[model samples]
Target: MKVALLYNQKPDLPENTPKYQSDEFAEWDNPETIDAVANALRERCDVVKIDCNPAYLQQIITTLLEEKPDICFNITEGIGEPSREAQIPALLDMMRLRYTASDPATLCLALDKARTKEILSYYQIPTPHFRVIHSLSEGMVFLNEHHQFPLIVKPLHEGSSKGIFERSVVYSVEELSRQLREVIEQYKQPALVEQFLSGREFTVALIGNGETLEVLPIIELLFDHLPKDSRKIYSYEAKWLWDDPENPVEVFKCPAPISKELADEIASLCKRAFRALRCRDWARIDVRLNEHGKPFIIEINPLPGILPNPDEHSCFPLAARTAGIDFNALINRVLDEALKRYNLAI
Candidate 1:
């Protein structure tokens, strides 16, 4: 089979680059992920890379049509634009092409944090009680009706711990108001003020079709490694703080020591969430343990990261490894699952 792997790698950069520009994050675009997928598919199929750009999207489609690949293994993480993240998959669907990962509907729904939470809540999946506040006045409703203090606040449509900080977890009405104003004015996105869960945070990796979706080893984020003054939360800096010696980026422990009952609860709820979102292929489910020791579904990530290095602090890869599958084997499993869904003989 010939396969084209699509990624949302950034399209271009400024020419005549200066010395400071070389280290920019955009410089580390999509090749690494593309290369990882390419390496795995090289042995089983003819693989090609298609980096996406709306300006030259026609060229990508044209080339793929020419190649006539049997399928597409999408790994695109289009930088800068969130909406474009679903563009490649939607295009693949329009062409009636089989592709790996969740469908466009799931991708778009997961991209909007507020919508994801709403779906989870509708299904009676436990999560932090949250309200979407378009302005400071709306935040006052959370204060008056919910009567919840020490809530967490952040942009309603972003992930990867961006725009989250100690202040994001507020303890007082004054603090909530200030954070609400900052999120509204600066991010220009609606604010999500949620009741804080003081217990542990976990990410559960799930694979297979909805009928038999499998939950791999659950991973825990160790809060003890965080700085004394920092809140026991994962922030953008904690995710990308290179210079901080005490960063807990390396503190992930797989198959976290939660009781078997809680583990089963989390896994069952995760599968339900995957079904609720119409998640296809595979996904990762985030959860939190409330003070009562019950696990709550925080959110679902349809396009979970799968870097090759399990030790590099990637939850999906680590879970795959714990499930007794190597990185290449895991990638192949994803391909096989997608093919099966398309009724294509492997």
Candidate 2:
């Protein structure tokens, strides 16, 4: 078998530059994780890195067709446009190339928080009520209605907790509007203001094909050190503020403590959502409990992080380990599922 990594290799529009001519941010799906997966594939297959940029989709498509790899370990996150993450997958779909994770349509839908929630709601999966605000004026009015106090605001198209911070949590209408304007001005896009459900948060990792999908262990964010006044959200600061020397999101804990029944309920709902979205190879579903302990999905992460650490905040990998699958074994399992889907010899 032969494999290639499709990834975004550009930065976002720089703050100072005009939207049309800003320097791009560099994103390569992270080389270490790709190398780990590649090494795992090396045991029985050949792997290559195709550093793809969303702006160069035509080039990526031409290159991939030329290489004709047996499979692609798609870790691409498109840069610039809202549909950036979907670019590589869309090309693969057009070329009839086999890749991993959710399909192009699903990727596009998933990246749009509002649309994803709409699908989940239609399927009867529990998620927070949210309104997509395209402008600060609309936000100001919507804030007065349709939302309770203590809401959360975020840039609709960004993932990995981008544009999310402690101030993203609002306890009053005024604060919500202020945050809304700030987000719109900074992100230059609509903001998703969601009803905040304050409680324990967990991530469920899913792997495998249609009928044999396996839900790995539930991972929890232990908020033992979080202050009573602060909201328990995995915001940008909590996720990436490594240099502040005083960051406060407590360490994440895997094999989250919960009753067997609650765990089963989460796993069941998550599996349903994954199947509904037609996710393949692997994905992560993030769910937070309401005050009453009911699971309300925060969101689905089709492209999950598999950083080389079992303990410090890599939930999916931690869950995989809990299932008695090592990193290499986990990667092979995902590959096995993809190969089976493609009906090729493993």
Candidate 3:
């Protein structure tokens, strides 16, 4: 089988870029990650890499038409509006081409955390009670609400922990207002302020489609190694800047040591959220417990990160390893699942 690997390489920003601007556009696939996926696919199929930067998007379609690959192993993470993640899939669909990962609709809906929560709430899926604040006036509504504090705020349309930092958790109306202003002015997007989940946090990685969907080992995020003043949430610094591959932060514990009952409950909630969001091929659902130990969906990544290096702190790959699937095998498994979904013999 011929596989056209579609992806977005992280941009090489100029040295003088303002730190804030750099952080806003920092979510892109690392070169090593793209190479890892291609190498894995090369073991079982002819691989042709196509960078899906909008500047040369036409080249992707041209390569697909000329090379006539059987399918596209897409991992494109475009920039711009919240719908950016779905743009490449939408293009492929227009050309009647098959690709991996969720469809454009699911990608768009899931990318917008506010919309995803609304859908989850409608389906009776437990999620943090939240509100989207477009301005400081909108944030005033939170002051009167009886919801408990240590509220967490994040950009409505970002991933990879962008716009999230230790200061994202607010304990008072003043703190909430300051954070809201930062999100609106810096990210230019509404801020999603939710009642913080104070209990343990775990991320569940799933592969395959429908009844065959396989939930990999659950991975817990530990903040014990973090600085004393740092909040428990996974901040951007912890994900990208501070942690090192050679000496990774002791943050992840896979196959989380939990009771069978608790594990089953967490898994069930993930599967429900995955199906409710209409996710296909593969996805990573983040679940966190509240004070009572009940699980709630924090977010779902239809296009989960697959950082090749284990020490980079990529949760999906870590969970796959716990399930006895190595990096190469994990990549191929995803492709095989997509092939099966499209009714193509592997």
Top-scoring candidate (lDDT): 3
lDDT of 3 by residue, 187-300 (tens): 888999999989999999999889988889998889887778878888887776556566766888988999999999988889999999999889999999999999999999
Q: Deviation in angstroms for 302 in model 3?
A: 0.5
Q: Candidate 1 on 127-163: residue-level lDDT in tens?
A: 7877888986776776566456778898886767767
TM-score of 2: 0.89
True-structure RMSD for candidate 3: 1.9
TM-score of every candidate: 0.90, 0.89, 0.95
Q: After superposition, how far is residue 169 of candidate 1 from its true place, in Å?
A: 0.3
Root-mean-square deviation of each candidate, in angstroms?
A: 3.4, 4.0, 1.9
Which candidate has the top score in TM-score?
Answer: 3
Between candidates 1 and 2, name the one with more favorable TM-score: 1
Tens digit of lDDT per residue, candidate 2, span 102-203? 787877877888888988989999999888899977876786675577789888887777778889999888888888998899889899989888888999
lDDT of each candidate versus the true structure: 0.78, 0.78, 0.88
List the candidate 2 regions with Cα displacement exceeding 4 Å: 9-27, 54-59, 242-250
Q: Model 1: which ten-residue window has the lowest total lDDT? A: 19-28
Q: Candidate 2 or 3, higher TM-score? A: 3
Ranking by lDDT: 3, 2, 1
